[model samples]
Target: MAKKTNKYIKPFKNIFVFILLMFVVWMLFFDANSWLIHHELNSDIEDLEAEKEFYKNEIIKDKKAIKELSTEEGVEKLAREKYYMKQENEEIFIIEYQDSLPKNKEK
Candidate 1:
């Protein structure tokens, strides 16, 4: 009986020690804060990459616009639309939107 009990107890002790060691290792290296921080850093890196891609596309668009503006026709069209420039005798009219009024009656 004593031998049988000793054999069973020995196995249980080994299992308990293994579990304890694993728990210690997990607490030291795989805690909640470490996982959270890693996830946050990953998200931040993803956001930065997206921002970089957006800027890259914006640079391409700006380069294309610059190339277009370097030509005479493109410059004249831009001036006509943006600056409202016209021929010497042309008149300019300004129109205001009704939505530009304040929402509050008191104001």
Candidate 2:
């Protein structure tokens, strides 16, 4: 019986086709502008964009807080809530529920 060969095998045997395939592989993986490098750079850009959006939101929130704190009422509210400050001759009470407290895990 004659040995069987596929018709498609001839293309791979051509020197130009092999060189072109190598060049394509080199450009995709080994060149300075490789696909892997581009993918990493694109991911970095996406991360930076997300971080930029986060900082922008934070700046807006900070600006609003600054605007609020510019007033006397805002300062009193922040002091009462955060610092638990009380006016002279006034009392302060704080209530905490069990579920709101941190749970302890014991081994």
Best by lDDT: 2
Scored against the true structure, residue 87 in model 2 reaches a CA lDDT of 98
Any runs in candidate 2 off by more than 4 Å, and if so which?
A: 1-5, 97-107
Candidate 2 pairs with clashing backbones = none
Candidate 1 lDDT over 39-70, as tens digits, reads 88899999999999999999999999999999
Model 1 segments more than 4 A misplaced: 1-33, 91-107
lDDT agreement with native, every candidate: 0.85, 0.97
Give the worst 10-residue stretch by lDDT in candidate 2: 3-12
Task: TM-score for candidate 1, please give it.
Answer: 0.57
Alpha-carbon TM-score of each model against the true structure:
0.57, 0.80
Clashing pairs in 1: none
- What is candidate 2's lDDT per residue for 13-102, written digit by digit as tens? 899999999999999999999999999999999999999999999999999999999999999999999999999999998999999999
